[model samples]
Structures are given as structure tokens and as C-alpha cells.
Target: MNVEFINPFLVSLVNVISTMATMDLKPGKPQLKNHDIAKGDVSGLIGMVGPKTKGSLSITFEAPLILEIMHKMLGEKPSSINEEITDLVGEITNMVTGGAKNLLSDKGYDFDMATPVVVSGKNHTISHKSKGKKILMPFSHEHGMAFIEICFEDI
Candidate 1:
């Protein structure tokens, strides 16, 4: 992925989501995910395929952040990971991907996005073609910790 093509979406998506959710988020240095940078399970993923590239957008969070986000978004305390919260994470990932898709499309890159897939665990890495650039944008609310990773390859 060209950094120029990818960075705008990363910044824009974080900006849109933070504004809508009323949270302040900053873009931490993005790097390719390797054994060193990743922590817990990856929560949600959405794949993108364009004329010149293919990649995926993923969202990950610590358990506490997930719980707190669920509570705040749903107006109830969540004691455990349920379908609802997992679904929300997936939807959020999809929304972010959509934002990227729209931006890329406007730049004359036509692409289609796949349905988001959500996963749970403590370890797994999102890998893409080593041809372009890999980006991992970390975000945190004053009260919640979350990150979104976007990986793309230019064909």
C-alpha cells in the first residue's frame, strides 16, 4: 500500500470515529505487525480488494476496553464477551473500512470490501503482501484503549 493512499484513511477513520464516539484518539507510529508489536487477540477484520491492491482493516482491544466500550455504547454493564459486543466490534471495523473505501474510490481506485470477520484470542497477526507498506494505527480514549490496523499491497 502506498503510504499516501493508506494514511489518509487511517487518519480519517480515526477522526470520524473519535468524533462520533466523543473520544480523543491519536495515531501512534504504524508498523508492520510482527511478534514484537502485537499483544492480545485481534477482535475484528474487514478485507479490501482494489484494482491495484488487496488488504484488510482490523481492530483490536484489550478486554477492559471492550467491556467499557460495550457498557458505554449499550447503556449496560457487560460482564462477559457476548455476541452483541463482538458484533459491534465487527460493525465498527466495517465502518472504518467503508470510510477507507470511499476515500480510495474518490482517488480513482475502485475497490470492493468484504464482510468483516471477528476473532478472539491472545495472539494472531494480520499479514499482507510485503510489497507495499504495512500500517498499524493505535488509538486510545482517555478511558479506553483500542487500536486499528490497516494493511495493503499495491498491485
Candidate 2:
């Protein structure tokens, strides 16, 4: 896979998360996870398909991070992960993926992206069909941790 193809995804992650959560993020070296990634506390999934291959983009975080993010996004403290909070999570991923898509298109790479699907609770995995690469970027806020992972199959 081309390194150029990967950079925009990372850039979009940093930009969206930072803008929405008011936290700074950096492009750390992409690393692979050991086994299948179960949904931690919150997860946002968006599918992408192009001529060469098809895959999905997901961002996952634990409860602390999700709570803080929900608070920041809504400008108030959320008592729990209810429907309102769930809506916010899906919207956040939608914004992040949209940002990435725009950036990627600017660089002449275009594809169709599905609407974000948000899943909560636990014990679920973002299953991939092919042997894929996992790129993890960790972000921190005063309250908690939020990370972005780009998992995609190579064409």
C-alpha cells in the first residue's frame, strides 16, 4: 500500500478529534493490535469501498473517554451512555470520516463512504474480511483517553 494513501486518514483523525473534543492529537507510528479489537466502551464504524478494495474505518474508546467526549460535544455532563450520547458518538465518527474523505479527495483519491454506525456496550469486534493493517493513534485529554484506529485491507 502507498504511504501517501495512509497519511490523509491519520491527518483527518487528528483534525476531527481535536476540533470536536478540543484536544490535541499527533500521528504516532502506526502499530498493529494483537487480536481482534473488541468494542471498548464506545465505537463508531464507517465503511468504505473503492475500485481496488473495500474496508471500514473505526474509532474506539473506553467509558471515561466516551463520557468526557460526550460532555464536550454537548457542552454538558452526560449522566450515562443513553440514546443522546449514542447519537453523538455516531455523529462524531461521521464528521471524522467526512473530514478524511474530503482530504483524500483533495489528493485525488476518492471513494464512497457509508453513514457511520455507532455501537456501545462491549464484547463486539470490527471484523475485517481480509488480512488488514491496524494503525493506532492515541489522543489524550485532561479527563481521559481517546484513540483512532484505521484498519484497511491492502489492494
Candidate 3:
């Protein structure tokens, strides 16, 4: 992935998360994760297709952060990862993707995003079809931490 392709997602993630959940998040420097399977308790994945590239992106949250976010969004404590929480994550993924898509299109990377797919379990893994580099960006909030992985391939 070109390093310039990362800025949209980074800006979108921080802006949307702060707006929707009313929480502040800071991103750490992105690093190459030399693995296919992404590790986390809850993961939301979305596929992307564009004229010049095709790939997928995922936002994975640890258990504690997932719960914290859900509670903030739903205005109640979530005991576990239930359907509502899963849907919330999916919507969040969609929101981030949409914002990134808008920004990227301005930079000439027009893409359509697929509906989000959410998976949750104890240390589950998210696998993508594309064999692209996984640029992992970790985000931290007062509640906990999560990771956003961008896998992009230029055609």
C-alpha cells in the first residue's frame, strides 16, 4: 500500500469515533503486521472495490473497549458481546468506511464499500482474501485500545 493512502482512514476513524461515541482516541504510529489473521476479541470487517485498487479493512477491538464503546453508544452497560453490540460495531465500521471513502475519492481513489461483517469471540482472528500488506494502526482511548488494519492493493 502506498503510504499516502493511509491518511483518509486515520482522519476518518478519529473523527467518526469521537463524534459518535463522544470519546477521545489517539493513534499510534502504524506498523507492518506480518500476518494474515488479525487478533482481537471483536472485529468488524468491510470489503472495498475501486477502479485502481481492491482490498479490505478491519477494525478490531479488545473486549474491554468493545464493552466501553457499546455502553457509551447505547447508554447502558453491556455484559457481553450481544447482537446489539455486534450491530453497533458494524455501523461504526460502516461510518468509518464511508468517511474514508469520501476523503479518498477526493484524492482519486473512488471505491464502494461492502456492508460490514462483525465477528466476536475470545481471541478470534479475521482473515482477508487479498494477500496484501496489513498496516496495523493502534488507537488508544481512556477506556482501552483497538486496532485498525488496512490492506490495500493497487491493480
Candidate 4:
């Protein structure tokens, strides 16, 4: 994957999360992960396609961290990952992906994104069927940690 494509995701994550969830986010340095699966307790994933590129956008949360974010969004503590909580994860993934897509449009990376899908369980894993590598960007909130992973390939 080209490094030039990275900043859009970082910018979108910080801006969207701050405004929507009212939480401050600190991103750790992004690291390349060449693995078959990404492990997470809860995940929201979106697939993107362009004339020359194909990729997937994924956001995964720690069990408790996702609940905290849902509580903030709902203004009440959420006890479990129900339909509503799962829906919020999809919305967040959409917003993050939309923000990045708009930003990248100027660079001629205009792409179409699939509807986000949410998955939850104990250390569930997501596998990306890409021809390139994955970049894991870990973020820290006052509450806990989560990760945004992008795996893209030239098509």
C-alpha cells in the first residue's frame, strides 16, 4: 500500500470521533501487519473499491472500550452488545470511511464503499483477502484502546 493513502484515515478518525463521540483520541504509530487475521472483540468493517485499488477499512474495539463509546453515544451505560450497539458501530465505521473517502477524492482515489458490517465476540478474527499489506493504526482514548486497520491492493 502506498503511504500517501494513510493520512486520510488518521485525519478522519480523529476528526469524526472527536466531534461525534466527544472523546479525545491519541493515535499510536502505525505498524504494518502481515498476518492472516486481525483479532478483536468487536469489529466494524467496510470494503472500498476504485478503478485501481481495492481495500477494506476496519475498526475493532476492546470489549469494554466499545461499551464505553456506546454509553457516551446513548448517554447511558450499555450493558451488552445488542442491536443498537452493533448499529452504532456500523454508523461510526461509515462516518470514518466517508470522511476519509471525501478527503482522498481530491487525490483521485475516489472510491465506492460497501455498507459496514459489525461482528462481536471473544477475540473474533477478521481476515482480509488482499494482495498487499495491512496497516494497523492503534488509538487510545481516555477510556481504552481500539484499532483501525487498512488493507489495500493495486488492482
Candidate 5:
């Protein structure tokens, strides 16, 4: 995976979470992911396709972290995963992907993003469409942890 591909997502994640949820996230080291099982309780996945490349990006959040984010964003935090929480996950995925898309576009990479899909469970699976290498970036906030996974390849 190209190292250049990872920066935009990191920048976007920090920007989106800071602006919308008013929370500061400390990013941990990014590593190559070897499994399909999600690291968090909830995940939002979206695909990106372009003339030159195709890929997927997923954001997964632990229950406590997501609940805190929901509280900050909507002023009401649910006790557990629900429709509204899932919707917020989708929205956050969309925004972060959109922001990264724009940054990549500036570098001459054009892409069309599919609607984000949200999934929640104790140990859910995340199936990224692309066969590219999956890079996992973990982030920690005051409440708990979240993860961002990216997989991209030339098609």
C-alpha cells in the first residue's frame, strides 16, 4: 500500500471528529490488518471507485467511544447501539470518506463513493470489496477507541 494514501484519511478523521464531535483523537500506529473481523462494536463501510482505482474505507468504533461521540454530536447518548447510533456511524463514515476523497482528488485521483453501510454487533465482520492490502489505524479518545481501515488498489 502506498503511504501517501493513508495521510488524507488520518487528516480527515481528525478534522471531522474534532469539528462535529468536538473530541480530540490520538492516533496510534497504523499496521497491516490480517483479518476480516471488526475490531469494534460498530462499523461503517463505504466503497470508492474510479477510472484508475477502486477501494474501500471503514470506520469502526467501540461502544463507549461511539456513545460519547453521539452525545457530543446530537446532545443525547443512547445506552446501547440503536437506529440513531447506526445512522450516525454512517454519516461519520460518509463525511470522513468525502473529506479524504476531496484531498485525493486534489492529487488527481477522482472517485465516486457508494453509500455507507453500518453494522453493529459484539463481533461483526467487515468485508471490504477491494483485494488490496488492508491498513488499520487505531485511534483513542477520552472514552475509548476506534479504528479506521483502508484498502486500495489499481484496477
Candidate 6:
């Protein structure tokens, strides 16, 4: 994957979390992921297909971070990962994907996005649409850590 493709998602993640959750995020170095196991407790995955590219984007959040997000966004401190938390993850994924899609579209990379899917478990697995290597971008906030993974290829 071209490194250029990663920027929009990065920007979007920061933007969405900052604007919606009112959280300050510092992104860590991105790395190539070699496995399907998720790095966090819950994840939101979505697929995109375009004329020039096709791939998937996922956002995974640790329990502490997500609970903090829930408190900030909904004014409720959830003790664990529940349906509401999962739904929030899905919505965050959707917002981030939408933001990135707009940025990429401005660069002439228009695509259709699938509905986001939320998965939660101790060590859940993510199946990206593309077979390419996943790029894992980790972010840190005052509460905890989160991750964003992007896997795509020019089709």
C-alpha cells in the first residue's frame, strides 16, 4: 500500500476523536501488522471499494479508553464493553471512515463504504477485505490507548 493512503485515516481518527469525544490524542509510530488478532478489546471494522482502490479500515479501543470516550460523549461511565459501547465504536468508525473518504475523494479516490461492524472479545480477530499487509497506527490519550488498522490495495 502506498503510504499516502494512510494519512487520511490518521487525520480522520484524530479529528473525529477530538471533535466528538473532546479528547486529545497523540499518535504513535505506525507499523506493519503481520497478524489478524486485534490489539485492543473492541473493534469497529468497515470495508471500502472504489474504482482505483479497495480495502478495509478498523478502529480498536482498549476498555479504559472506550469507557472514557463513553463518559465524555454520552455522560455515562460504562463499567465494561456493552452494546452501547460497541455501538459507539461502530459510530466512531463510521465517522472516521466518512471523514477519510471525503479527504480521499478530494484527491480523486472515491469509494463506497460498507456499514461498520463492531467486534469485542479478549483477542478478537479482524478479517480485512484486502489480502495486503495491515498498517497499524496506535494512538494514546490521557485515558488509554487505541489502534487504527488499514489494509488496502490498488485494484
Pairs that collide in candidate 3 are none
Write model 4 residue lDDT over 1-155, tens digit each, in one string: 56678888987888877787687789888888766355667899999988888899899887677788777666887787778778888988999999989888988887899899999898887777787888888888767778899988888
Pick the lDDT winner.
5
Clash list (residue pairs), candidate 5? none
Q: To one decimal, what is the Cα RMSD in angstroms of model 3 from the true structure?
A: 1.6
lDDT per residue, candidate 1, 1-155, as tens digits? 46766676677657655654555566676665653364545478787887777777678776666776666655776776678778877877777777767776777877799998888765655554455555676766665557676666777
The lDDT of each candidate is 0.68, 0.70, 0.83, 0.83, 0.88, 0.86
Give, for candidate 1, the lowest lDDT window spanning 10 residues: 33-42
Better of 2 and 3 by lDDT: 3
List the pairs of residues colliding in candidate 6: none
**TM-score per candidate, chains pooled:** 0.81, 0.80, 0.91, 0.92, 0.93, 0.91
Better of 2 and 6 by TM-score: 6
Q: List the candidates ranked by TM-score, beginning with the highest.
A: 5, 4, 3, 6, 1, 2
lDDT of 3: 0.83
Error of 3 at 72 (Å): 1.9
Model 6 segments more than 4 A misplaced: 36-38, 127-129
Task: Please identify model 2 stretches exceeding 4 Å from their true place.
Answer: 37-39, 123-125
Collision pairs in model 2: none
lDDT of 3 at 151: 87
TM-score-wise, the better of 2 and 3 is 3
| Highest TM-score model number | 5
Candidate 6 structure, TM-score to reference: 0.91
Candidate 1, residue 17: Cα displacement in angstroms equals: 3.5
For candidate 5, the TM-score is 0.93
The reply for model 1, stretches above 4 Å from the true place, is 32-36, 123-125, 129-131
Residue-level lDDT tens digits of model 2 in 12-108: 7677767887766545566565556445677888888776656777777677767876676778877767787778778878887887778778877
Shift in Å, residue 122, candidate 4:
1.5
How displaced is residue 142 in candidate 4, in Å? 3.7
